[model samples]
Target: MIACDNLTKRFGHFTAVDHVSFAVAKGSIFGFLGPNGSGKSTVIRMLCGLLSPSDGHARIAGFDVAREPAAIKPLIGYMSQKFSLYDELTAHENLNFYGRLYGLRGAALRRRYDELVGLTHLAPYLNRRAALLSGGWRQRLAMACSLIHQPSVLFLDEPTAGIDPVARRELWDLLFEFSSQGMTLFVTTHYMDEAERCSQVGYIHLSKLVVCGEPDDLKQLPVVNPPDTRRIDVTCEHVTVGLQAVRQLPGVRTATVFGQSMHLLVEASLSEDFIRTELARVNIPHADIRPIAPSLEDVFVALTNNRNGET
Candidate 1:
């Protein structure tokens, strides 16, 4: 339901977003992933009509961002990083105000208010002031406020930041629930676990999207020598020496030290006997060897680090 063409944004001599282009399918949750200062927020703002692009163009729900911002504004809901709600207003009051802003009134406004309260699990707190709510409650309140008008598209910028893991999971469940009901979500998050939950993810770095695909597809991107395919944990007197010795062994791709132990990534065909023989040659006491699936964090780190080196 969203599309961008060579989108660019600049302030003075620095470009915040550089010729980035991507599309979000209707009813899909598209995760925008990046480190600090990677322009995820800038792009989001531009798409939401809160900011104008310096170059290129974009459309939301088939309306041009620049030429038809007003028509699109009411069709999308935006929840910024900051909690944007009146602290003194009760949960019901806050939604009431937002509903009015969208031209909802009387029974319509009351119905939406009650529906949002129920969806966000804030029914019990309907009479509680926003400021009195805890972080998780405030977050849910903010989300409810954003959806008060039942917009077709939702823009969430780090909505789960600073919340506990359990709260984060609950919030994600809510997002998936909304998505299942046909609401398109455009979210920006630093957490890899959340990124993995998205239907598709765009990995941004240095104002550019380095990769965009499903989480598993991104993970399967070609790695050097298939990532050595094995991990060996060893505890030795000299971890550094053991690492260096492992690096020299055949089939060993990389050896990294983790605390007092070293993790070796070696070819799958290499047997424990061969690894033990290599350790014996270096007089490094060995501990154990096992296989583990590579995580999303591992793939992300590898891609970003490799990109940094290239630059």
Candidate 2:
């Protein structure tokens, strides 16, 4: 439902999105991941018709984004990062306002309002002012307002940014529900776990798209799963100490502390016994070590480091 061919955006001498291109199949959830100021938002703005591309082009459902923005607008809904809402208006009033803004009125407006309220479970806070709602509730309200017109595609820019864990999970649940109903979703997120949930993902850095594919496929990329290398996880006390020790080992390519464990990339010849002995030297004995697969974060880290010519 979405396609971009060498989409480029420039501001004077600076390029924000450089020759970026990707496609999103209908009913699929495409996660766009990148660091701050990496041009993720710039691409979204260009695709949404809010900003004109300096070169190349993008299309939504076969309609040229730059030339037929009006036609595309009716086919897509956008929920920005800020949860755009009228602070003084109650949830119910806000919904009505957006519904009218989309040209819904009378019976039609009432029906969509009810559907959104039920979907977002905002009925309890219908009379509550937007400013009075909590972050989670405010996000739901924003999502409901975005869906007031029932567009086929939804663009969410970090939809779970400031909410609690429970709220984040709940928001994703709604996204899954939407995708199941054949609604295409384009989401930008900083969370690795959220990216894993997407049907396909694109990682952008330094205004360039580094990689784009399914999570498993990206993990299998040779850049990530290097030849003659094996990934392992070590669960032990003083993980930082274990990490430091393992980093100095000859065959250990990368060692990073993850929670109470350490994830390491090492040569296949680097046996677990060798790692255990190294940990023992640092008084971190009795470690539980096991082989593991590369995670989405690992894939991006490997690709980013490779791009920067780092070992």
Candidate 3:
């Protein structure tokens, strides 16, 4: 339902989105990921007809991004990172305004408003002003407004940014509901766990698409494990301090704190006894240290490092 054929975009002398290409199947939730300024948003704009690509093009719901930019707008929905839904208006009023802007009138507008309210479960907050609603409620309101036109394809750029964890999960539930109904969802997020929920994921780096595939396939990539190296998850007290201590040890290629645990990409020859000995020497209290599966974050870290020649 969505395709990018060598999509390229430029601004003045700077190339924003390089010749990136990927396809999204119908009813699938595709995750777009990258560091800041990696052209994730640039590619979204080009696909949504908000920006013109300097070279190549994209298609949404079978409409050419370059030739039929206008035609594509009506076929897709876009909810930007900072949603511009009116703050002074109530949730219902905001949807009503957007519904009208999308050319729904009278009976059609009312029907869509009801459908969106039911779909997003915004009925309880319908009369509440957007500014008065909580972060989660506001996000749902923005999502409803974006879908006021009932577009088949939805583009969400950092939709869960700055929201609480519970709110993020709630929003993802809605995304899953949309995908189950045959609506194509393209979402960009920095949260690794959120990317895991996507059926397909595309990783962008330095304005180029470095890798694109299913989460399991990405996790199993040889680039992640490399040669003579393995990954281990170590849960230790004082996680921040433990990270500092563990990173200074030999054979530890990469050490990062994840929640209450620490992930280390270390030399496989480093024995568990050796790690325990080293941590104990520094008085860093640890619960358990064991080899573990590579997570999505590990895959991206390895892929990005390899792509940038970081070894």
Alpha-carbon RMSD to native, per candidate: 3.6, 1.2, 1.8
Model 2 per-residue lDDT tens digits across residues 1-311: 99999999999999999999999999999999999999999999998999999999899999999999889988989999999999999999999999998899999999889888888888889999999999999999999999999999999999999999999999999999999999999999999999999999999999999999999899999999999999999999988877888899999998877789988999999999988998899999799999999999999989998999953
lDDT of each: 0.85, 0.94, 0.89
User: Which residue segments of model 1 deviate by more than 4 Å?
Assistant: 224-288
Q: Compare candidates 1 and 2 on TM-score and give the better one.
A: 2
TM-score of 3: 0.94
lDDT of 1 at 4: 91
lDDT of 1 by residue, 245-278 (tens): 7788888766767678666667788887787778
TM-scores of the models, in the given order?
0.85, 0.98, 0.94
lDDT of 3 at 166: 88
Ranking of models by TM-score: 2, 3, 1
lDDT, residue 19, model 1: 94
Model 1 clashing residue pairs (backbone): none
Candidate whose lDDT is highest: 2
Q: Which runs of model 2 end up more than 4 angstroms from their true locations?
A: none
